[model samples]
Target chain A: MKKFTCIVCPISCSLAVQAEGGGDITVTGSKCDRGKAYAKDEYLAPKRVITTTVKIDGADIALLPVIGTAPVPKELLRTCLRHLYGIKVTAPVRMGDVIERDILGSGVDIVAARSAVIKKG
Target chain B: MREITADIAVVGGGPAGMSAALRACGLGAKTVLIERDAALGGILNQCVHDGFGLLRFKKQMSGSQYAQQFADAVYESSASVMTETTVLKLIPGECGSKAQSRQGLYTTGEKTGGALIRAGAVILAMGCRERPRQQAGIVGSRPAGVLTAGAVQKYINVEGYLPGRKAVILGSGDIGLIMARRMTLEGIDVAGVYEIMPSPGGLRRNVAQCLDDYDIPLRLSSTVTEVHGKKRVEGVTVADVDAARHPIPGTEVFVPCDLLVLSVGLIPENELSRDAGIEMDPVTGGPVLDNFMMASVPGFFAAGNVSAVFDLVDYVSDTGEAAAEGACRFLGGEALPEYVTVRAGDDVSFVLPGKIRRDLPSSALYMRVKRTIENAVLEILADGKPVYEKKHPIVTPPEMVTARFHESAGSGVPDAGGLTVRILGD
Candidate 1:
């Protein structure tokens, strides 16, 4: 049995999950179906969207904000961010432009959150 | 001085101000919104993190994305917007007079010293500001690297500069917790988060996602006693505090760090409210409001953080709409009925709309608890009789609670002496 708070909503419902050896799991204390689904996935394989900034060269701004196009495995967030920190892209980047595809082989693309235009020298 | 006239003037172009301006214009009022910044989103532009607009939009979105939704609406509406404009002063009209006589002193470019804006009504939504290090009373010399959490956030998210390589956060507020995760993602070392309260000041989800997920240590009942540095922040002294929040002697431990980020708290920005001669609530640190969101002066109204700090932006928008409706009613020349005082009882901190107009169709009392409690029952009493009650699994100070009352509920009592809200442990 494991206990945790469901982050699916602001209610923060307290959840308790009990799993049998045969992969059977029962989640209790969830207020909504979303919480139940979140708890089940959290017990099985947790995933989260990682948002951060990446360096951009020859742009009006020094950095561009980016986010994972899809939720990646929870444990791989740090590795993904480390890879992103070391990389830099030059502008004419648009929102949703993929800076890195299949980041860390997690099958998630890191995309720009906003457009950054090249600065005229 | 140049003179401009409008039916409604909204100060501050943040989410609250934009929503209020839109609502007023939708009600057929000639509205103008003044924003001090070049853009309209205000602080939301710098807040790029996700988890906003869940309540209003029913979908999770980033702060800037949520703000853009409102900003787009404001742009499409009939309301006129003045960017890069500052309101120097608010001059109230005759006390208890109608809504059309008030005037605001404003300035646009540097060359234009000042201009006068005469409006039927004014809605103040300037929002709150971060409590700086000096207000926290930490014994230390002034240093460069010492900055507030909001400043660090703006620098990293907007300016795109890493403020420091290593940092120690002084308070465990939501901003500090979020910054802990942000700095960690940027490969900055977070020494630890020291909070003076027994429990975390931020939301539970923030504690879990921002601090616990990143392996950042959260030390409750602890605080930074002193700062150590001559030029830049070299370190900070952490110590545990006693029940009275005084630092216990001989428990100081020095931790080395390059930056000291203060997330102490927020104070409602109410300079215009004060200058307008509106009555203030000392406990909430904002103007005293009525059920219609009107200040003591009839034509002046306030909402959002300019009235009081709110936990969620959804509530801020709600208040904005309410203030707009109130302004419309005042402009329509509707007579106000008798007002009943709303008081805070045991275990409750304070309540917004200190008074309620008996003629209102319905009124909602927003309040916070003094402390965390479990298995509690919240009750609203009128003339020592319970008028409303609701059971809660748990309640915390960080989360605001709202209770609604209709005029029909008080039909029997001709003149309810007072209404009080209390939280009782089960």
Candidate 2:
């Protein structure tokens, strides 16, 4: 059994996670339904973001915060990085700008996280 | 496609939705509150923090307590609160959008779609959604552990789960800072928080109370460049970004961690609004409204996060009450002055209630900065006349700034017909 705290609300509950007889984890100490679902997801198939800076080839700036639209599988993050090597974009990068779509064919896009100037210097 | 109606239909059930519903019902309007979730509380239910309710309740309380206050008020007001009711579309009715259709497989007996009651006014308090890593342009490898700060909050606070044992946060928004402290209490090592800007995206109190007090390291003018690891987030590389947002060649280092938490920003949920054909401002991501907070549709009004993202729940409640009353007043056939529109000028990032009715009962201006400035004076301009200006000590890009232009601040203005707010630096 592992003790954990729920991160969904401020009432971060001290929870006990134990593997039941059927190889399933049971979560205790959730304050609400949302927490309950989150606990289950955390125990099974944990999801998260894919963020990285994309190199802008021609812009005065070197990089921009690029991220995937959704969480890729927990295992595929490395293969995803191989795709961005030597990749670059021109200047005047806008927030929400897409640098590469379906990056590495991983069903995720590398998008600009913020707007940036191409360059004047 | 069925028609359903109420005396007053409130969209959303967060602080604003509840406040509006309670006020409308208190004022004797048959109210219907619609929420997209199975529960009534909007983001508050997930916010386990205790800083809320300072202004309205006159006491600092937890988000749940604050939400419960409205919940109890709602119950006593005898308002009909519908959970998991996503409003599919808004069509004109006998009052306005007299004919409307909502789709839900369940709630047929309890909800009874296609029923008619005929609301005279409508209040929209749909709240907002967080901007994802894509929207924020966070750089890194695709990994399993990075989640939005709010999502992290939901996972840890609500469900009793730990997202990670060691974590790195991108963006110092309130949630990120709050989570920084939260992770510490859980004995999780918070690797660091990185922001491209020199300042934070949250309030001064949050910085001092949540981060400084906890001994969490917050790096400014820095950003993460890549996510490392094959399956889970093993670590990230932090680098300094120049004034032009370029990575400095020599300023890169790798910080190993299992989780990355994002506290970027929020976008108002406007899908239903768009389906209803309400006009939206591209910048604010919400419906343009008259001073009454009423949208372009005559009887349809918006408030709270649905109108624009706000820093405080107090403001949400304030706007929510206004929307409720506005709905009642409209339904009662109250006459309003023709509203003139308000615009955010060059220095301004965006303003809420993008439109103003000529016949406004009361007006409140909410705004954020296009970027950070210091030692500035706020100038409220009306038809090119300086109406209200105040000296400010410091301003940051992320923190929202608010100044009221009620009757008290009147500068002998003749153009009460139309007005706008502007900021100038000393």
Candidate 3:
């Protein structure tokens, strides 16, 4: 039995997961199906989406905020951030522009969180 | 000074200001949004983290992305926006057909010169600011590395600079938890988070994802007693606190760190409101507002963090929309009705819209708890008679509870008696 807090929503349901010999997983205290799915995934192998920034050139700001398009393996968050920190993109980066594809082979693309146009001369 | 005329003048271009300006424009009123920052997104520009706009968009979005949704709409709308503009003063209840004598705002813009913005209604949307170390009451030498979590966020996410390689965060609030994760991801060693209260100040989700997931330590019932640095922060002395939150004598521990981040609390920026002599709420530290988000002064409104510091940006935007709607109503020459006072009762910190008009068909009241409790019932009472009740499995001080009341519900809400929101717990 494992206790987990569901972060799927603001409700923050505390889910109790029970499994015996991996036969079947029973999740309790989740208000919605999304929380159930989150509990199962968290129980099997925890994962999280990385949200951070990367260096950008020719933009008004020095850094361009980015987010992983999907959640990746939780353990690889540090490695993914290391990859993002080294990478730099130019201005004209649009929202959803892929900064890095298949980051750390996690199959999640790092996309720009916001658009940054060229700096005014 | 130059003069600009509009139906509505919105100060601050954050989520609330943008939403208010957009909503006001949608109602066919000429709206002008004035922002102190260079960009229209305001604080959201530096808040690069995800998990925003969950309620409104039904999906987790980065703060910047969430702000962009409204920013894009504002740009497409007819509402005029003035970035890098500072509103010096608000002269409420003074505007009319005449340009010079109109109730208006005195503002100065970096690109555009100082101007008198005459408007039929003014919506104050300036958001809250973080409490610094001095305000947090840490006896320390003035050091360069001590900064608020928001400032560090801007430094890392916007300026691409790391203030320090090692840090100690004070306060277990959401921002502190998020910054702990952020700094850890940026290769900074966070010694641990020291919180004065026994319980975490932020949401449980943040504790689960930001700290627990990252293997960071959350030390409760502890606080930074003293700072030990001169030019730059060298270290801090932390101590465990007793029930009264005073530091225990023998429980002091020295932790070496380059930066000390303060996430103690947020106070609504109400200088303009105070200067205008608006009735203020001693608890919320904002304005005494009515159901329409209208301030004590007629034709003057307060919204978003300027009214109360909200946990979610969604609620902030909601207040902004309400203020805009109220401003539009004021412009339409709606007559003011008798108001019923709304009071905070037992176990509640504060409630927005300090008062509500007696004849209002419906109104939403946002509130927070004084402490955490499970199996509690949130009850709304009118003149000591129960009007509405909701059973909650749990309630925390950090989480806000929103209760909406409709006069047509036949809930026996009186027009003369005041409304009191309280929590019934064992």
Number of the top candidate by TM-score? 3
- Candidate 3's clash total is 4
* Regions of model 2 farther than 4 Å from truth: A1-121, B1-4, B92-118, B138-141, B359-361, B371-375, B407-417
DockQ-based CAPRI category assigned to the predicted complex of candidate 3: medium
RMSD of each: 3.1, 18.6, 1.9
| TM-scores of chain A, one for each prediction | 0.93, 0.76, 0.88
lDDT of 3 at B22: 92
Score candidate 2 by TM-score against the native. 0.72
Steric clash pairs (candidate 3): B94-B102, B94-B103, B95-B102, B95-B103
Give the fraction of native contacts in model 1: 0.23
After superposing candidate 3 on the true structure, give the runs of residues whose Cα lies further than 4 Å from its correct spot. A10-13, A16-19, A22-34, B95-101
What is the descending TM-score order?
Answer: 3, 1, 2
Tens digits of lDDT, candidate 3, B1-426:
898989899999999999999999999999899998888887889888888898888888999998877888999999999988999999876656553235679999779789999988899999999987778997646978899999988888888788999999999988889899999888899999999999999998999888987789999999999888889999999999999999999999999999999999999999998998898898998999998999988888988988998999999999999999998888888787888888899999888988998787889999989998888898888877887888887889989988897766636656567888999897
lDDT of 1 at B268: 91
For A1-121, candidate 1 gives per-residue lDDT tens digits of: 9877788765788899999788799999998899999989988898888787788989876677777777899889888888988989999887678999999889999887666678977
Ranking by lDDT: 3, 1, 2
* Weakest lDDT window of 10 consecutive positions for candidate 3 chain B: B93-102
